[model samples]
Target: MFFDILPRVGLKPKDYILKFILPASVISLLLLILGITYFSGYTRLVVLFLPLLLMGSAIGYPYIELDSQRQKINERLHIFITKFGVLSITDLDRKELMHLLATEKEELGQLATESHKIFVLIKRWNQSLAESCRFLANRSPSSQFGDFLDRMAYSIDSGQELKEFLHGEQDIVMEDYGEFYKRAIYTLDTFKEMYVSAVTSVSFFVTFAIIAPFLLPYDFVTMVTVALLGFVLIEVLLVYAIKSRLPYDRLWHTGEKPTKIDLKLKKWLIISVIGTVLFTLFLLWGKFIGEIPQIMKIPYQIIFALGMSPLAIGGYFAQREENLVIRKEFNFPDFLRSLGDSVSAKGGGMTDSLEYLSSNDFGPLTKDLEGLYKRVSIRVNSQKAWRYFGYDTCSYMIQLFSEMFERCTFLGGNAGVAAHMIGKNFRKIINLRKAKYQSVSQFSGIMYGLAGGMALTLYASAGVANMVNGLYTSLDIPDTMISIVNIITPEDFSLIAYLIYGVLVIYSIVSGYLIKLMDGGHYQVSLMHFVIMLWVASIVGYIAEVMTGSLLGTSLPI
Candidate 1:
């Protein structure tokens, strides 16, 4: 039904503001105004709900569009560079090679679309290759690709060999790619610093907001709502800002068989589920039925901490999987170097070279290497077999390197040369990744500390509010002073505690995901970090509650 209406309003996927955000804003504003006018005393409820509607409209769809665009450009650009480099060195003719490049069915995102346009202009409209390339260059979305096209057009006009130009251009592209890789790492380092500063500052603000009810005559619920919204907004925007700078490539691979690790994770998962359920039941019974003793009563913060334990356990397993993959990748260049040495010495093909190399230890990759040797030795569709070999490795750099090697070898080119090039490029990338991870390691401590601080401050603020409210009600104040008192009762403090607790839950998750994304180049590996951060929030909240109660017992009238 929404889709049916979307077209009527000139909405499309690319026009994010018109397609999603503008309509969301219009509807939210209308609903907000209606609630304010029709309902007498629910302004706080309406205001509290507005953040989700407004923030999603303003930031959500735009970020989605940007992420989509980044993926398309990255994939397309990589494919073009890899393919152009390999085909240039092959014996395929200029026109035949250009035809293959232009008409290849492999989707290089916008690159494919533009290349197809160039092909159509030349073959259908009878435009020369130079003319078609010139036209395409003028309209290309990526400026770097445009410059490449413009150079290609010039090369054609001057009667220079397209192969030579492409071969030379690969060196330039690789250099640019190295710089690009470095810039992304630098951006991540900068983002980490910004994140620490932003989260710490927001933590202090939330603390102040929580304490405001004691001193200021404002709606306590409204103040909590604003604090929650403010924290959520900063975290969400920070995540959005970094999405564009992260790598977008992913590897495809053969199915992975379950191992001992899977079995261990499964057992822990069951235990976590049962433990969480039991904890929740205990909390409910204490809250609703009053069956538990006062000393045994579990706070909501403690309950939240216990519930997220399973995710942490599961995340550890995920981190292990990533670690194994990285270990395999770390030795990949050595494997490539060995392959090149074997091929150069024995004058054998990739299959024979791999059969000998499989006997050597490639660290974590030894098992996969044996599998690849069996497949290729059996002559079971070499290209498909090598592709799965790349996929099984599950490293983006390996995928790219393997594709280049596969292309060159399939073209009956020098396997030794291809291996050397792949090894060199892979080594450079690996070193950059190590440096990036090392640079970002210091920020992890900052995150853990800041997350705890935020949680503690929030919990302490709630404790103070409750303590002050209790004293205000019990005291024999003047009638005039009683009218001026702005007290948050114990019941109201419970609501605020739960609300702020929920906000902290989200902030911790987002921050953990951000840390993982910056370090691992993906967020799927963030579960461990997320779980740890949640535990930090939970523990800090409890500690703050205990300390606040003890301190106030001496300082305030009981």
Candidate 2:
């Protein structure tokens, strides 16, 4: 398996052995010897595993790289194939189409690299397209991509029209891609269940640790620290698991040129940072100084909420832009179809077609469409103008399909057909995104509910324990019974409170990022959820403390 993957990853067996395996083996041997000579007991055991782990990683590196490449290709295969079909409808022949695709490194990613390799084989080696496709098919890391290549080779040899073959392949590939996408979502759902179960278990453990001091001789802080560490590890694993399974559906275009929205987002981000720093400083000063106002001496929960409040401004703006992008994406298919029809009707005059469509309303996309028309009409760089339009909309899909539309029309392809095909596939992806969004929305609600429940349970347990300790302190019990009870003290409760707060912070941060992973949104957009979840947990904790204190007929220190 290792040798097979090495070739797929472009490494010869001898070279891989000489460059990686030999060096790794020597290092592993030396490490194992050193560990045995220098370490003792459990430390020796841990060090002993280090060499084995290192050797395992060295041996598996090629397979890992191969899988990474396979995933990258498979993730973007659907979109690449769709774009390929659109471009195949144009006047560019097979080689030209391949070269053009090879140039689109940003949009196609690894697929572009593969396309460039194929182009090199055909251009440099004078191989026929069919032979080149077949040659590459054997070595391709992705089974799906390899299968497509195999089929393309047969179609080429059979003298089928490239456009028609791609049109058929598009449907087949998309259907497969849909199944692949659904499988990813199913994995996400399974991970969500796993996450809930794991977190609940950790919460129970934490509660047990908080109350354990009354009976067990274990160090309370140490026990809680272990639980918190375990909780963090679980969250990290879940984040990684979900991220690995998520589809490569990006919302924002990754262009070098900054859009107006990008600039505004940056401005708001700066404001948020400045405000957070200032607010945090003020809170820290109030905390350290004895002259803090009585009203400002609220619980840490409120303090955290206020400190994070400034971030919401930037988050809200980013979220609004994200929504605006979705809205524009929804209207993009119609815009493309209309533009295609116009271009065809006007005999391939892109500027004239844009002028005609500029008068039409495309919902949130109308203004950007007008801007595109104006730029192209004035003979400004059409590519830059369309790029700006895409950036203005902040939709990655629009950038891709619009670029395809512009390129195909410029090549004198059947504009109406290209538009229809692009629009149809674009709508399919949008529908899939809708399904994903619905799933994430439900998951969001669950996360919020979980956060509240966790906070309440944790704080309520702390409150009840503290109240019990207080009650025991106020009792006039005999010395013998008092010694046997091993009651928790005020200082212990304070430590537990701090530990619980730490847990809440960790949970809030992890859960917020988890939501972002499921939805495939920008991390900055996740700040809103983080702030909201943090506030929910904090407020719930505060309420739990107050309610528990009242129910226990005690005035707990606020």
Candidate 3:
């Protein structure tokens, strides 16, 4: 299987062996020699693993590359097909359609690359379209795309109309895409379970580490650090896994011009930065410089929460913009359908059609639609006008499909048919995103609950350990008993408390990022989840410490 994938990925077997495999083998041998000669004990053992890991990665590089190519191709294959179908209904001939699809590299990525290869075969090699399609199908990495090419090859050979073939393939292709989407969601669910189990186990281990130091001769700081690193590694791996498994979809448009929401986000971000700095300075002063009044004396957990509160402003705006984008995307298909019908009815003037449609309510999309009409009415460059419209709406799907609609209608395609096709696929994609959003919502709730639970357990353990230490210190015990008891000092408990706080902060950041990855939102939006998780951990941790102190009649000095 590895060898077969080489040619498909444009790698020759001889070149692979000489250029990659042989060099990696030599490097591994050198590393093994150095490890045995220079390293000792466990250090040598750790070094020895590097050679094995490197060789294994080198050997598997081809398979990894093949899988990556397949993912890139399959990522946008459904959209590529939908756009291709829309173009097929236009007056474009086979060659022109292939050329146009090949040029859409920005939108279609590897699918467009494959289309360009097919175009090269047809144009340069003078092969028939069916022959080229069949040739590419045989070597395509993605089974779904390959099957599509194979069927398209047969249809072209049998004198079927391209538009008719695509119309028939839509349901079949969409079903496959839906299945692919669901499988990804299931993968995320599995990873979510793994994350919860792994992180919970790590938290318990860290708690054990904190408590065990009081009973055993262990370095409290070193044990906690090791456990924290393990926790971090687990979260990082889960994040990467989730990111790879999720489908590629962007919530925001990537136009060159910044939209009004973008400007608002920028302004709020600056304000957030200034607020963070001022709040942090105030906390520092209260901690080290100023006298704390009775009312101002609060737990450090609450102080940390207060320091991060300013970031909520930026997060709020970002989330609001994302919501607006979703609403615009939802309303876009209806607006497109109406505009298409109007264009056909009025004999094909887009500006007039848009003008008529702009007066109708399209939820968040109405203002953007009106702007598009105004631009077009003033004889703005049609492409630029539509592009600006996409930027204003801030919806990736709307931008892509709107471009398709405009291009097809300009080329004399049936606007109604084109709009219907684009809208159908657009709606399907929206439904998939909604399903993903629901899953992420459930995952977010689980993460928040886990954060609170973890904070309670971790801080309660620390509090109990502190109380035990205090008890040992207060009681008049003999030197022999003192030597046997091995009670941790107040200073040690203080350090452990800070370590627990560190763990909570790290957990909050990682869990927030995981949620953002699943939902395909901006990273700034993760700040919202981050702040909430932090607050949850803080409140739970404070309650646990207070409860433990009241029950045990001792507490760590803050």
Best by lDDT: 3
lDDT of each: 0.70, 0.84, 0.86
User: Count of backbone clashes for each model?
Assistant: 0, 0, 0
Residue 197's C-alpha lDDT in candidate 3? 90
Best by TM-score: 3
Which candidate, 2 or 3, has the higher TM-score?
Answer: 3
TM-score of each: 0.78, 0.92, 0.96
Off by over 4 Å in 2: 283-297, 464-489, 551-558
* Tens-digit lDDT string for candidate 1 (220-322): 8888889789989999998888876676433223234433444555665666667667766766677658666762466666666765666666666656766
Instruction: Give the 10-residue window scoring lowest on summed lDDT in candidate 1.
Output: 1-10
Ranking by lDDT: 3, 2, 1
* Backbone clashes in model 2, listed as residue pairs: none
lDDT string for model 3 (385-468, tens) is 888888888888888989998888878899988988888888999999898899899999999999999999998888777877
Candidate 2 versus truth, CA RMSD in Å, comes to 2.7
